[model samples]
Structures are given as C-alpha cells and as structure tokens.
Target: MVNSFISGLAGPLKPDLEMMAICKVSIPGLKTGKEQTSEVKRGRDPIFNQEFFFDHVTIEDLDTKNVSITAFHHGGAKLGKDLLIGEAVVPLREIRELNAKKEVKVIEEIKQAIPK
Candidate 1:
C-alpha cells in the first residue's frame, strides 16, 4: 500500500508534493454541469465590466467509484462557450446490465440516435 511505503521515510527521502489530483471543483458541492453568473468588480482604478460567468460543476465519473452522490441540485442555463469543466461517460455494458435488473427501464441511448 502507498501508506506503508512512506511510513518511516524522512523529510528529504519523502517527496515534497504528493497526491496528484485528476479533477477539481470551485466549491465542494454547489453546481452540476451548469452555467452560473456572478459579478466581478475592479479595485481602486475601476474597469468597464461588472460581471462574468463562473462555471461550477458536480461529477459522476465511471472512471472514479469513490462516492455515491444523490439528491443533486438541478437546473441552469447553458452559455455559448466551448469549455468542458466536468464529464460523465457511462459505458454501454453497465447501462445494459442496469436495464436487465430493473423491471421497468428508462435509458437514454446516444449511440442509437445516429442512423447508419
């Protein structure tokens, strides 16, 4: 385990920076794949603009199975920007398995939307 490897290690032997993060969040559990607008003010000298769009997100990663996030906060307008702040990619196999388990199924199929 990672804990055992560094347990007795000294300062110089131990790496200064550890736990490289693959993802980030602006606030702990505030937003979810939505556009939120807030105000920005220039100090002292003052500038033209008063506000800008701040993107906040909550995640559901198939790659990460660390937590179960339920009772999610919902609804926000999508702005016309090409910035991808969060992701959700559910593989086909898992979706199929869920469908098989459930008595009544409701699944969104993206792949089937396109015609061959």
Candidate 2:
C-alpha cells in the first residue's frame, strides 16, 4: 500500500514538484508485480490511500523477495520524459519478522530520502 509522499527541498535537478507513486513487489525466484497511485497535482505533500494484493504468494516466498515504491513526476504528454523523484526498497525479511512477532497490524513509518 502507498500512504503518502513528502517532497524534499528543491535541488538543481530535482525541484519541489507534483508527483505520483508506484509500489512494486517481486519474488526473486518467482515473479514481479506493480501497482500505482493517482497523481497529486501541484502538491509537495500528497496522500494516497491505496493498497495492493498478491495471490498465490506464500510467506516463505516473501523471505527472499523485495518491495520497491517509486515516485514519478510527469513531463507533459511527451513520451519517455517522466522524471524519477525517488524510490524505496524494502526487504521482506523485515515484514516477516514483524509477522512472526504478531505485529502485522502495527503502524510503522519508514523514512527514506529521495535519490538525487
């Protein structure tokens, strides 16, 4: 699930701009999957109440898998002109640990800076 986006201070190449986010999950030895949220127009801070689900996946499969959430800025309707804001990669081991401890419903916030 994608919760929100908070833009960082403007830089030479990355300005404080409007954007959207996408979340992708992949099992290294299995398959790759992705999901996206709607664009938040002209927003430095955006909120997205979205969730994604994968079928036929087991907890064991997640042990070696990864989740990546990426943010993007649109550059008009032009092709191949989208700007990459940032991305966060989460190892499933962290999730598995939480699940093992029966903390699956706990709200945890992870702060990751956008890549320059």
Candidate 3:
C-alpha cells in the first residue's frame, strides 16, 4: 500500500492574461488509486491540502506509475472554457525505493510544462 498526500500548490503560470487561475492535482490509476484535489479559485498561487491512498501498489507498479499534478484556469460563466496552466509528472520509482529503506516521507517541489 502507498499513501500519498498533496499538501498544497504554489506559483501557477497563467496561460491567459485576463483569466483567473484555479488548480487541482490528478493521479490516474485503478478506481481506488485515482484521485484529484479540490479546485482552488482565482489566484496565481493556490493551495490544496488533500490526501490519497493506493492499496496493493507494488514496487513494479511504482516503477511504471506516475503522479500528475496540474494547474488549470477556470473561466467564468461568460467564458465556459478551462485552460491548463502547467503540470508535473512525478515518477514513483525513487519514492518507492526510499520508502522501502525507512518509510520515507517526501515533499517535492516540481516545475514543468504541461503535456500536449
């Protein structure tokens, strides 16, 4: 079993000059593993304090699995389109290894481009 927590988010890159930014975190996996953070509203920096747990996740699965954190812009009622700001893909292999040694707890600060 793997326990994951999304403590918060910071520094959202706004795609549009006039849009308010909202952020969320998404991790894709089996029904039990899949989770996302609640949306943060109207700011360049947003904070989301959320937690997720993945039961029966093995080392092999960790090697192949990744946690995706994403930031999005919520358009108001007038403009019904949401825009993506950025995302980070964190591979779990290293985390798994560290945890195997002594139950490592890590908080990573990642900055990367959103996937197309």
Candidate 4:
C-alpha cells in the first residue's frame, strides 16, 4: 500500500484533489510491471489501502529488482494532465531483509520529483 502526503507544498492547492498511487516493478533485462490504485479524494494526504503483486519474481531476480511507488495528482478532464507529486524507491534486497526479520511494513519518505 502507498500513502501519499504533500502538506506544506508550495503554490496554491488545486481545486481537484483526486490522486492516484502507482507501483512499478523493474528488473534488469526484463519487462517492467506497473500497477495503480483508483483515484482517492484528499487535499494533501491520501491513503491508498491497496496491494500490488508481480508474478514470476524469482529469488534470484530480487538481487537486481526494485519497486517504485509514486503519487500523482489526477487532474480531471479539464486539466488533461496528471501531475507527479512524489515517489519512493525500494530495492528488493532490503525488502527481503525486512521479511526475514518479520517486518512487513516500511515507510519511505517520498522524494519530490522535479516538474517537467
């Protein structure tokens, strides 16, 4: 699950607070898998209670795989563009270590993505 919070952000807050959470899994020399949660309504803090899974992920692949969770402001039809708020990346190895210690949850601070 991905929880997005962008309080204290610069600039005026957009009227439409709809937001989406995306999860992307990447492995070297393999096709990437992406999953996204339905848009949520929250001015600055959106909690996405969801799960994403990638099939055929072998133990060997964990060494070279990473998971990226991203949050985007879903501009409605009027804007026609989704704005990226922030994202966090986690290596599979770190996740493995967490699991070994019976720790299944991790909180990674989202690093703001520079707007294009």
What digit string (tens of lDDT, one per residue) describes model 2 on residues 7-99?
A: 451234345544443323333344535443455566555554444454444455555666666666666675456677667777766654445
Give all TM-scores, in the order shown.
0.16, 0.53, 0.53, 0.55
Cα lDDT for residue 66, candidate 2: 66
- What is the RMSD, in Å, between candidate 2 and the native fold over all Cα? 10.7
Q: Per-residue lDDT of 15-113 in model 1, one digit per residue for the tens?
A: 442211112112223234232222112122112122222232112322222221111112124433322223333332343333353221322243345
Model with the higher lDDT, candidate 1 or 4: 4
Residue pairs with backbone overlap in model 4: none
Model 4 lDDT-worst window of ten? 102-111
Question: How far off is model 4, as Cα RMSD?
Answer: 11.6
Steric clash count of candidate 3: 0
Candidate 1 Cα misplacement greater than 4 A, ranges: 1-82, 96-101, 104-116
- At residue 56, candidate 3 shows an lDDT of 56
Which consecutive 10 residues in model 1 have the weakest lDDT in total?
A: 1-10
Per-residue lDDT of model 3, residues 47-88, tens digit only: 554444556555456667776766666767877887776677
Q: What CA root-mean-square deviation does each model show from the true structure?
A: 18.1, 10.7, 10.9, 11.6
Best by TM-score: 4
